[model samples]
Target: MTVSSDRSPVTDAGAPLDGFAVEGSEGSAAADIAIRQLRMLGAASPGPDVAVRGAGRARARAEAGSAGSLVLAADHARVACALDWAGPLALPLEDEPGVQAACGLMHVHGRSSGGPRPLAIDYASAVGGVLSAQGLLAALIGRLRGGAAELVRTSVAQAALISVGQYLAAATASGDERDAPAAPGGPPFTSADGVPFEIETFEAERWERFWSLLGADRAALARGWQPFQHRYAAAVCPLPPELHATAAARVFREAAGAAQAAGISIVRVHGAAGERRRSDAAEPPPWRLTGGSSDTPGPPPAPCRPGAGLPLDGLVVVESTRRVQGPLAGHLLRLLGAEVLRIEPPGGDPLRWVPPTVGTCSARFLALNRGKHVVEADLKTPEGRRQVRELTAGADVFLHNWAPGKAAVFGLDSADLFAVRPGLVYAHASGWGDARQAGAAMGGAEPLGTDFLVQAHSGLGGLVRPRGEEPAPSLMTLTDVLGGLLSAQGVLAGLLARCRGAGGIRVDSALYDGAALLTAAAPSGGARRPRWGPLHPPLRTGDGYLALGPHARSSPDRVARALGADRPAADAAAAVARLCRGDRAADVAERLRGAGLSATPVCTDLADLAADPRIAGALDTGGAAFVRSPWEFTS
Candidate 1:
């Protein structure tokens, strides 16, 4: 394979690298993104001697890498083929309008009775490819350092997990309640004069301050809407007539302004009629490597035989992370055959008490943190600090998601740790990229790196909004999941450098960078706004909902036949809708499959997901039925 030595920044006008062709088909957009990232990191040449293959075959190659050169693979359908056990589902390569409709992101809509319409952009596949590429890069780095070649895998289904992880976490907690708690009706509201704006006051103090600023009656607050759960439930359920009237009175820009003055978060909702310019300038590169030199050389480590264990066997990681992102990275590392010891505060991670508890563990905590060792430490104390330093002395990787500078306060920053472990791979996951960016975004105040705030700040809420309606944040914490995966990728890349006898390396990933990548990857122009279109959106069958692709065939009659209806071409949609309305969604789906047309039931709840035979084997029944990591080692 021919490898290019041109190490230059990739731009929109950059030429494609040679010898990096995806095997067995035309290169997919997801592959293109992954290849670009890998090339940028100098892990692989534009023409690396690699062949991308199917997940099943790729798994075998990765397993064999335990005794040989590292094998890196990216399967576009890894999740569907491996995790869901759905065979050979081909996804669109480009970010088309209806791509998300296939996944159910399009089902999220304004409070209207209209048919399901496509969301503006496709995010899952692109993110999946990018993350998969990062994973492969990490493996490649490991291989170069005398480590055995490893297999790196990523799939669209795995990427789609981010869009629903929060919901899945909630589902694991509540058993039957698959939905997360609503955080009040904070969407954009129209003023009496017709100007539109949005406001948020999820915190109790912020809500009280907002009420005080609005001069609302204390009696209104006394009606027992103080707790967030009550407010969240109120937001999801229809408001009573009196409550509606009261809420309707405050739908004005002035109310939003007052709320903002009281330290609440608020913004004017932008329209799709005009091009939306990005508020911040283009962000810096998503990944950075530090403390590695090309001139250094060291004896390669011994290669191990395949099938001994996961690819990361014999690796040691020290993690000081909590909540979703950092813990998630550590979780993946643990699954990949690394020994991860999670260090929690003396009082334990705050997530331990986040409700929907099974005995003492929260569902969120359990879902993100499985198969890892844990310990308690008080970083404020010298002994705790000494303990951490000792742990780092023997660790290959040190991972953390603390607020920017919190590590420095505890003397656990890269500089401090490198003194003890010069060859350590330091990975830092954050809500924002670095202190400068965080300061600029928060006006010099300490920023809370929560997923929701990052979503709003990154303009994702506006991008997903229906036309002429208030922007809504996704119920899923897309950034947190993606950030976690990317952070893991960074750690792997650092490890690769260390294998090359490079000194201590620091890798940085953040929610802001993930969001920016999603935004940047979105197709420019030609986006179909959400609306009821023929062959688009889910159709209501009598017993349930079904999403069918209109572009899958040349004739609408074929669609009618797929739905088991014999009707004229002109009336095909109506006939199919009528026929499906009378039949069970499963039966209709089976019949459509028999006819070779693409179709799927609109899964409305976690129970529906759990009922699937493919998913049944992966559910954890120890407490609530939580989903196991959607990956397996063939070896």
Candidate 2:
């Protein structure tokens, strides 16, 4: 096994580090193993550029002293450790196109051995996207002092979270007991704004808010409305616009300031994109990849075990993108270890103040703009565009959601940027592709709008077909995840080409594209799976959903028997519903799924399952909630 190492020395004498194989060629290990010899200079400002070193070299280094050693290996998508990491180091995920999850190496000196054991920090939450060496090293150091080797997991919608919750619950409880809510590492069923209600101080001759709103209504006062309100109810109180925005912008800050003065952890959480680093320290020097050559890494872990390989690393991405599509690409790329910077137009990305929501943010924006750096630069302006042009020059990858015509106006249509930013990997994410956006050969921006229409046009609704008695299929958040993956995948593949001097731009991700991708799943062996579903054939799992196979290539009787009654009748739905109502959802799900037949009650929200302690116990890492990143970086 070969691994990559950061700028530190090789602790052991196994073999000198080597690079990865190029994308198109293989079989020549000699060229693949050529290490980049350097005159050793200061770190670059562009950020650390990671490359693979044969795993043999990694083993040699891990054997050396347990400090100043940073190991970063690209497994194609998720990075892995060659050996246990043990020192102050900043391990950023590679900024390549396909990478999905980056890892921070954490080494806690073992208490008995008087040395630190390995630990890792997966910063998918509140990610600032600036993986500076100091910042990275600092986080690793903090973890060693007390941080657990956390497992950063990812789940799509409540479905993914529910399965995880059930697993944790089963792992924690003893015989017969089905419920446990206080389990450590479980998510709060409802984590409300912690502090209760507050009185807003007005600039005019005004009294406190609660005193004014309910003081006159003693009836309301009885319900704590006037004063003793359920702190939550008071907090949720709707205020007049003038007073609300004013107090919110200033009053909360003032109150929080006071609390902090008195030693409290009081802070407002902005959207992930707008979130700031815990420390102001400038982005650290980029890692110097002075050793090793080549680009493409090894194979990735199958979906069954995501730990096998990392798809992305050390790829530079500038997303001059917006709305859901562009930001979403940046978000997913961050997971894959891509260095993604979301360059916003002046006054920030239009998303900064879109959807006309409360509190200077949009709910949709918050969810989509995570894991990337948000910077204000108006591309519409000549100067702004020039600045962006400069930024993109060094960027190995670029993505945008603008229509081709409009993007072309700003020098981003197709491979135009490649002229200025040579050998760059580029992609465009759009709701409507050039075909749909065209109007009598006037195919452009004016015609494209509304994600809903995109959904409808792509036959997303048709994909649902119809069941016996259920309503039509609904719009799903999964579209965003899938679309985002498409765009990132394009960029990743482009980087792989560029790494070998074969770079070029490509296009991927459309609302229609996502719909088509889903539609493709309907077929197998070039024949479509019959839409015949009593919703889902009378089976153990019930309506609209069916069980998956054992992968063993044979029908195992053990699975059939464990599924209990194989025949699914109308009565079975009632039975499952009945069990769920009695809090037996966990037990029944486990027992049935244990049989290797796909089973689990459709969870409306992950909240309930997250609260179950049995589920929480299985996740005792830094995953504040039971939901976590799918890959664990164990080299």
Candidate 3:
């Protein structure tokens, strides 16, 4: 089904931002688009529509009138300076190699046997855009509550870092090592008919049952399960070769039949043509905000002010979510000063013991769950649902990531919750929004909407790899990270609507929409595969590799000269590789940076990133290591 233009049901209700101006170079378009999308959702307070202008500092300053405007910038120093003049808000959108490397995203994305290569898509830049929008909403919320202006800052590098926070935590944790080498291996396992597809199952019994039906050896099935399960955290799956051979022995139809019989989910990779067909349809908005059952704003909020606290300070959030997307959303809200109370099943979440622990809990799980409270309850039971409703009664927000209809089955849906807590911001961080209807057009039996599966279905798997490489998901949990950010963005929008005299709001954010955003923002294939060569390509050095940022790619001649090569822009990549073959990656990167280019060593080791001084402030390495919040708020 094609996406509809009816995004936010409350768009016509209010427009708080009378003057919103974005200032920066052409590179700031990603961030600009994010702000505009939020405005489209009616996230602003009651006023005229958001006012957008050109790149000049003077132009932005002049346009931002006394109504308290928000100014976003691409330069960090420029934003810091703007805070003094632009009273309402000042946000920095920076995407540079130094931050990306420090954040360890470069390491995670490029992890493979063939040496580290840059992610084909502009992850840092795209995610930075989403973050910038969130920052604006948060700053606006602060202003509305405290009646004072604030400074909010984030960079592409920080966004990239948060995306890989789980992986970095696992790498630095104690006990058994959970990750395998970055060797080239993992899913989209090919069938005898040459069709590449991915399979997913959260239950080991189902995994065993599916492989057994496909005639895979008992030993292979048992051996492959760990790596397959580890794939999400490790960012690579080194499955036993026997399993690959097993899948290769059967046609796609036969393997699919086996999956159906076993009650597991399977989906073939969406090729370029199929992706083009899907892309032809209108992409869904980042989020959909609908009013709740109540027409009133519910209980009057307690008197609170931003003062010296975060934007969401004094708010309570009840979160019932498993896995990365939901937990990350709650985590982001907590960073914005909300008190998030996590609802886990009885005996706590099983993943808390997945290994590589800090103290008694898994560091990987803690990466996205630090600084949150937990409650034990089983939604399968009536009493458990009652307990959740009781918690939601006093909370400002209720967030969850249950299956499509699971919440309603337990009577914990938006309507049900709104009955108990009128103005609650109910957010469903789903895997796929209306997947059944949408999947019908995509031609499939409706696969489970997991991170890798969404990546494959959205054509991101094909786009993220180098041009000639095989198409497969990055295993970096790309969709989950961005989806989490989108979920938080939706929740903030809901809160903004409620603050503006609108009733309780219901927000729907999905991995599908997040993937659509990433794919839509990506450059066309031709532009990505430029005449000068691959955009932001990684160059191999004597000992390791160095990744060139977009800035460096733009000045190929400078790069060639720094590497002691003389060649036209088209051959600069080859020339640099040849000349830098005997130089250390760090040395080569330093030389390029000295030439006023953007380049950095591809941080293959998480430990190296922890040691990198440039982004030391972004990491909390005491005990359980994890990335800190990307945003730095100041009043």
Candidate 4:
């Protein structure tokens, strides 16, 4: 559906600007984040005529003829409504017996050394909202080209699936717990000043340097931790707290500094809140308009005939990327009916060899590259560069995630590619934005823009703390997932503008920028951060555990009655422990839910997820089970 022209952009000060505007149906942090991103894209706020409503009801109403391109943003419940699903939204981390079971969060959390609580963040919902917005924009763009208006849907459930898609694929492929190991844990070590720090060494040279810096005994090295993978595996295995404490006896800053100087990555664990960085005002917008007259090849490419199903039908994209972010963007486009050709180096994407292989392909690789065709080309070689340029001539979108200056070096930069295909949507995904911004942010160094480093740089580490403990990085690659979606958003926007007669544009999305947007709703200081802990902590039942939502705190009387306790709210922990000792988790959860409390039994393993009817239908069964992108379109 195409947006009505009445919508316009509005700033925080309430002044309406001249551009497309978006209005949210509900007031939610996730919705706010999505709107902020839209503003960054130069869209204005919607006028009064465009009444934004809950996505669930909107979809139902939309089907009845109010079908214009619509963007729906909400938490999981609203998403469930849009999909016409029964019951509450099954959040992966928020509730027990959630899709986390299918995604392997329970297994990983069980093995974590920190505590029983899983990584606490609404990342799935946040990312889902962003992706949903992107999908809406794509659908709207299609509508502009004469396609029927459609409802583009995304949910925390879908975001949850994307976050753990690789892990779930591995689990399904291996069909054995022992075969699918969790990613490394960035083992915690204590400094001499009693400060704890996490260290990550994913390379053999760096690992050796770390050991050498620590003056490790020869016997320790002989323990067979030479290979990088072995060290990664050893780091994640349960370690004694005392060992970390002893390691922390060294001066924290000094130790970290020394390790870093020797080319190791280390960060001290602290509870300090993340400092907000400057806006993108000094640099170009996350996605910018470029190559208008000087590089134009006349008007935008002619609209192609729409296909039967996907909104992006007949769109051709040439994707030159590896790893998660760029490939994920291409994957999303492919799901929406775009033809994506992944261009890899001679040896293929490095991730092709990542662990938990299904046949010859890594589960992670399979998850991201499922629908696309792939070809090998060395951009450094003249023949290979010529071949890529020839492909660009016929492609509508050119997507890549090369480092800042590598694009120009390889003659694949925006200026170069736009010269080849003046009407192409040139999209670049990176660790940071332009070279100046990235270099400045990294203290004049141009480091590789991997997911973990981007998380640290973007201040995500500061936002999540394990109650009373030091901050930890998200086990889920939150930044990578969001950054990828943002890239896809940029591409969609570019395509829409092109179709509207704007010349070819250059779209840039960075992991750092995406991370900033993820936490934009947070107050600068003194505002109460949402408590990561459950309002009612997990209760131990006879057979398993149950997680109850914080809303139950409002009616302590009801909670007490449901748990069969007289003063459960007074000493809630003890009361729940005493009352649930002999009851089954599923029974307690059902009873609490019946009493109007939000609660569910904690899923213990993949088997529980596989049995869930709601989750099973979403998994692709062609090979090892993996999630398909969460989108449904009607013409």
Clashes of 2: 58
User: Clashing residue pairs in candidate 1, if any?
Assistant: 69-149, 70-149, 70-150, 141-496, 145-499, 146-301, 541-581, 542-581
Error of 3 at 587 (Å): 2.1
Q: Give the TM-scores of the predictions, in the order they appear.
A: 0.76, 0.45, 0.87, 0.82
Q: Residue-wise lDDT of candidate 3 within 1-635, one digit each (tens)?
A: 12365544454344323234343333353454465555555434222333333224533542343212235322211121021111211211123444455356767766643445566666776776777678767766665565343456565666777888898888877656545464656787899999889999988999999999989999989988987888888887778888999999999999988988998888777654236444454445677777743356796334356364677888899999988999999999999888999999999998998877888889889998989999998889989999999999999999999988888899999999988988888999987788676568446666777998887766777777656667787878999998999999889887766665667888888997777777766655212321236435567779877667667677667778877765565676566667777889778877876887766666777866666665576788866568887776654
Check candidate 3 and list the clashing pairs. 15-45, 15-46, 15-47, 16-44, 16-45, 16-46
Tens digits of lDDT, candidate 4, 121-158: 44545665576567666666666666664555555556
Worst 10 residues of 4 by lDDT: 8-17
For candidate 1, lDDT tens digit of each residue in 503-596?
6677778886666655655544212233334445566776667666445323557768776555465677666667778878668767866776
The TM-score-based order of candidates, best leading, equals 3, 4, 1, 2
Residue-pair clashes per candidate:
8, 58, 6, 18
Model 3 root-mean-square deviation: 5.2
lDDT for 408 in candidate 2 is 74
